[model samples]
Every structure is written in C-alpha cells, then in structure tokens.
Target chain A: MLRHAIALLSGGLFGSGLFISGMTDTAKVQGWLDVFGDWDPTLAFVMGGAMIPMALAWWMRSKRVTALTGEPLPPAPSKEIDTKLIVGSVLFGIGWGLAGLCPGPSIAALSYGGPGLYVFVAAMVTGMAIAPFVRARLDRAVPAE
Target chain B: MPIDWIWGLIGGLLIGTGGAVYLLGNGKIMGASGIIGGLVDGSGLNTKWERILFLLGVAVMPVVLYPLYRDVDTHITDNYWVLIAAGLLVGIGTRIANGCTSGHGVCGMSRLSVRGIVATCCYILAGGLGVILFRHILGVI
Candidate 1:
C-alpha cells in the first residue's frame, strides 16, 4: 500500500512539475531544439534544476543496497554503449525533435491536449506493443552482446 | 516567449522530488517511457496496478492544474501524419535504448551511469540535427 501510494504521488508530482514548468509546451521544446533558429533555454534550465535533487538522491543511493522502503535497489546500470542503444536514441531524438512531445509531457498533457494526442499516444502504444517481437528478431539476427 | 528560469527550476525540483520518491520508495527509476514501455512489452504485469496508478496520477493532473497556466502554448503540430510517425519512433527508440529523457537524461545521469550519459548525448545531438533538417531545410513544422 505504501509503495503504491508513493508511486502515485511520484507520478502526480512529476506530471504537476512538467505542467507547471511549461515543458508540456511543444513550442518551447521545439524552440530549445532549434539551435539555428531563435532558441529558448528554459528546457536546459529545467534539466539543470532537476539534476540537483536527483544527484543528491543518487549520492544517497550510492551508499545503500536497499531503498528506503526496504526493497533492494536494482542492480547497477549496464556500461555497454552498443549499436542498439545508439540507434534507438537517434530514432527517439528524431521523433522528439519532429513533434517536441516526449513520453512524459505527452502523457501528462493528455487531459488538456485534445483529440490529436489520443492518436499520437495510441500509435506510440502500438509501437511499444510490437517491440518484443522486433527485439526477438533482432536477437536472432545479431550475435550475443 | 523569453526564458522563464525560475518556474523552470521550481518545476524541475518538483520533478526531481518525484524521482526521489520512486527511487527511495519503489526502488525503481521514475521514467515515463520505461514504466509504460515495460507494460506494453509484457514484462511489467507483475506491477500492473502500480503502473496503472502512476499513469492515472499523470493523466488526471491537468484537470486540476491546467487552470493555473492557461496562457502557455502547447503547440502540438496540426499535422496528423507527422504525429503518427513521431509517436511510433518515440516508442521504438525508447524501448531499444532502454531509456528516454527521464530514464536516461534525468534519472540515469543523476546516478552517473555511462549508458545514460551516452544516450543523452546521442538523443540531444540527434534531436538538434532533426530540428535543423526538418524545420530549417524541409520547412516542416
């Protein structure tokens, strides 16, 4: 029960923050990406701002094996920077730059974004649904990592 | 509009607090893409209720919060096909990379994960390039 509540609260806080910060504003995101065009630096500030507390959390995490709730923290992240990771990030960046809607803002902004958001989100979910099959095929074609 | 650094920082602190909640309470990263992506890819059923509640928390906020900033412009492009392509790409790419902005950029980078740093660099560069190609050269919005 506590865990669930925490997750819910976390999501709520995350959504509220994004909305409050105006990260849901697609124009602002696009502007930040628009280095050649008239650019906006608000997104950079948002990231920098987020980094402060998160870095502190990580510092706390570094010394501990279990989370505050007594659950074991997940293993250390993988160090590999393979082709799949690069290719995937590149693809994601293109889409993000194209639309200026990432998963967080898109999800959080759904209540106010009108009908088109549903279409975008549905297509995104479909792509996610198909990912396991795609991964399986790739695994067969590519050697072990 | 000009940069709004103060709000940006305040909002970011809130976001980080949410992340801290997830890390400390749930022992998980608070990444939107990863949370939902796990469910879609069929690996998150074990925590289905948690994910659902989290999404509900996210999906329900605008009702209460939208009034605060009626002037902000959320310029989701009017072009539908572009929206479709963008959505599909975001889904696949985040899954493939094992993270998106939240997972890699904010959460992972905070932990000093190399993968997160590399992925952030890749996506930021790619995003910048995309803006140049699509917005400048091709004149697409």
Candidate 2:
C-alpha cells in the first residue's frame, strides 16, 4: 500500500510539474529543440536544474548502505556502448524533433483531452507491445541486455 | 525562442524533489517509463484501482492548471502526420533503450546507474543530431 501510494504521489507531482512548466504544450518543446532556428535554450536550463538534486542523490547513494526500501540497492548495471544503443538514440531523437513530444510530455499532455495525446499514447503502447518480439529476435542473434 | 525559465526551474525542482522523496521514503525510482510499462503489462493489477486513479490524476491535473495560463499559444510547426510518426519512433526507442529521458536521464542518473549515464548521453547526441538534420540539413523548418 505504501509503495503504491508513493508511486502515485511521485507520478502526480511529476505530472503536475510538467503541466505547470508548459511542457505538455508541444510547441514549447519544439522551440527548445529548434537550435538553429529560433532555438529555445530554456529546456536545457530545465534539465540542468533537474539534474542538480539527481546528482546529489547519486552521490549520497554511493555512500549509503541500503536504499529507501531497506533492501540492498542493485549495483548499477554497466554495459559497453553498442550498435543497438546508437540506433535507438537516433530513432528517439528523430521522433522527438518531429513531434515535439516525448514520453514524459505526452503522458502529461493526456490532461488536455485532445486527439493528439490519444494518438501518441496509442502509438507508444503499440511500440512497447512490439518490443518483446523485437528483443526476442535480437536475442537469437546477439543476446541483448 | 524565448522560454519561461522560471517555470522550467519549478518543473525541475518538483521532479527532483518528488523523485528524491519517493526514493528515500519508498525505495523506488520514479521513472515514467517503468510506471507506464507496468500499467500495460498488468504488473500493478493487484492495485488496479489505485493505478487507474493515479492515471486519472495525471490526465486531469493539466486541465485543472490550464486556467492560469490559458492565454498562451501552444501551436507547433509540424503537422499531425509528423507528430504521429515522431510518437511511434519515440515509443520504439524507449522500449529498445529500456527507458526514456525521464527514466534514464532523471531517475536512473540520480541512482548513478552506468547504463543511465550512457543512455542519457545517447539521448542528447541523438536529439542534437535530429535537430541538425531536420532544421539545418533538410531545411524542414
């Protein structure tokens, strides 16, 4: 019960933040991504500000014993840069630039009750649904992590 | 081109603080990717009602807040098809990469996961390249 509550509250706060920041509005995001043409560097500042606490948390966790769950934190998984990572990154970038909405903003945008959110969410779910199949096929060839 | 940095700062603070609270109090990483993925996979079926309620909250908060800044124009340059294609691609990328920007860049990086660091870096590079390709190279702007 507690865990579930925490998850809900955390997500709610996150969503609220996105809403307050106008990130749910796709145009704002596109402005940020349009570096060469009317670039909005505001998103960078947003990201940077967000990174501050996250950085502190990482530093503190490194010195701690157990996580908030009282269980031993999993050792950070380390992996080499591979083709899959590169290809995946490229795909993500292209989509973000084209649509001006990523998972975070799209999920937050659901509040507007618009067709665009519905379409984006549907496609996101479809992509997730297909992931297992793609991973399985890749596994047969090169055992992805 | 001009952004409201004040709002961005506020958003970042909320995400960071909220994420930390969840971690310290609940021992969980607040990754949107994992939460949404779990929703679809039925991993949270035991608490289905709560999940639905949570999702409802997420979907309604913007409406509640929209009244304050209703005057702002939220138009985009791209058409519906472009946005749709972008959505499809992001979906696949997040799945393939095992996370999204919030998942990896914010939550995972906070945990100092090496994977998170690498993933975030890739995200930035890809985003940069995409902007260059679309706006400059292709003159799609």
lDDT values for all models: 0.86, 0.68
B28-118: candidate 1 lDDT, tens digit per residue: 9988998999888779989988898888888777567877675556778888998899899999888888889998999999888999999
DockQ of each: 0.80, 0.52
Best by DockQ: 1
Query: Candidate 1: lDDT of A81?
Result: 78
Reference-based TM-score of each model: 0.96, 0.84
Indicate the TM-score of model 2: 0.84
Q: What share of the true interface contacts does each candidate keep?
A: 0.77, 0.52
Chain A TM-scores, candidates in order: 0.93, 0.86
Evaluated at residue B79, the lDDT of candidate 1 is 88
- Flag regions of model 1 displaced more than 4 Å: none
DockQ of 1: 0.80
Give the per-residue lDDT digits (tens) of candidate 1, residues A78-138: 9987777888899999999999989999998888787778878987898788766766776
